[model samples]
Target: MNENMNTSTIRGPLDHEIRDQIISAATEHFSHYGYEKTTVSDLAKAIGFSKAYIYKFFESKQAIGAVICTNRLAMIMEIVDAAIAGAPTASEKLRCLFRSISEAGSDLFFHDRKLYDIAAVASRDQWPSAVAHQVRIRAIIQQILLDGRASGEFERKTPLDEATKAIFLIILPYVNPAQLQYNLDTAPEAAVHLPALILRSLAP
Candidate 1:
């Protein structure tokens, strides 16, 4: 075997287990070293695999970062959605969603700065997965508003499209990952107060 040959070509794309391992290793490197300083070769060495093997799974280090941020956002959304699923009223659902999202943000920002930093970069770079995650989050907020309108929890005549966008802007400070560090240190009270304002704005 030629030492110069691309090992990725010799070996097929990695299976699920190997792909997960690469993500796990990449997360560790990214967390400790930060994104710009972390390299594909670094992940390869840390995972006990050749650089080619890592490439066979991830297109680049940026892609790995994107996957990590996107997955984290998706999991948080799942938790938020699940928490609000059984709420008996639209008002309660909106409250649950806001509280759940606030809790998730605290976990990401206050407890895990490293992971939060990675997500901030992903959002700034406009990674496709990150963009998709934002769309899903917006839709979740929209659905809740629509439900509220139907149940007379919110003004029935309000336009949901505009309402959804407005709500996103109103809560942007608390929900945006890029703002997490600032909010955690200086504006902890906003987490509780902003959501209350949103709930009030939705009242019929």
Candidate 2:
């Protein structure tokens, strides 16, 4: 046994189970304590491991934070992907997009708020990946509209460029975290009205 091994990490096939356990424990710690208040020791105890045992799976607390953030983002992406996959029309895609943003106060996002805050503080002006994520989402929405155009399901009320921006507007605030914190109750309304607003703006 490597005594020098980090407590937050695990190895082998067992490591994955250990890894997920840490993430699960971290999620609860994060939600109640937020980023600053939560500690790796809290995580270890949550998993019934020693402080050093927790380090075995994670090199540092920051590494654990990274895992937490990525997991949450992946969850959000899954929801977004499913929405796009299930949509029969550009209009339906718009509704999913709206719902994505409106419901962003998810456990995943809430738990990883610390990581996001840290990133912004570390380099407020520099997030290439964040920019890229937005670009990809825009591309997906644009593709949906182009498909709508081909199917004659949409009237092409605006050029794709303008329409894409309009679509982004609907979901941007709700998922933004900062924006959604103001009022939690408006989410369902956001899910419904945003699509209607976009359709009104884009449909024949």
Candidate 3:
């Protein structure tokens, strides 16, 4: 789990098609067996590849998990982006952002618990994919806020960076895999009320 290790250097140039094949098999393996319990050898066996062959594409099991985690998170972001794009106003977009994340997180927790476990590890370990995801979410929120201000739908006095950070903090529980299950019972209600409160706060 040395985050600083240059895994790419260890593997040298990869064959994209073979690398993708490994990733696809590893993702299915992790989804069924869960990330923590599965090893590279197990994945190789399931995929009919030698363990050494798998290592040529990925330096460690975590590297494969990182790719899977990134793809899973990207799916959620795609849903959120579509929701935001379909909304008619900034207020609605903000609400869509919150609701989309809440529903998506809940779906993963309930329907894909094994994958959720991988996300929990990624969040706890501060994986590069998880960190990058957070940055992207913050940027999305900042854009929504800027749009709101430009439309005169929101107050302009607050610093944009602070506002973006605060808004992200408010929604973090819904999105953070480590914290999500604890808040699941309240998520449906909070998803409705929280965005309403935020919109009111932003109103000019």
Better of 1 and 3 by lDDT: 3
lDDT of 1: 0.72
Give each model's whole-structure lDDT: 0.72, 0.62, 0.88
Instruction: Sort the predicted structures by TM-score, highest score first.
Output: 3, 1, 2
Pairing residues by index, what is the TM-score of model 1?
A: 0.84
Best by lDDT: 3
Please provide, for model 3 over 140-174, each residue's C-alpha lDDT reduced to its tens digit, 9 standing for 90 to 100.
99999999999999999999999999999999998
Candidate 2's C-alpha runs over 4 A off are 1-17, 44-59, 104-136, 155-159
Root-mean-square deviation per candidate: 5.8, 6.6, 1.7
Q: What 10-residue stretch in candidate 2 is worst by lDDT? A: 118-127
Please provide, for model 1 over 2-104, each residue's C-alpha lDDT reduced to its tens digit, 9 standing for 90 to 100.
1211233323344578888878887777777777677778778877999987777766677677768877888888888888897888777777766777678
Q: Which structure among the candidates has the greatest TM-score?
A: 3
All candidates: TM-score: 0.84, 0.64, 0.94
Please give the lDDT score at residue 109 for candidate 3.
86
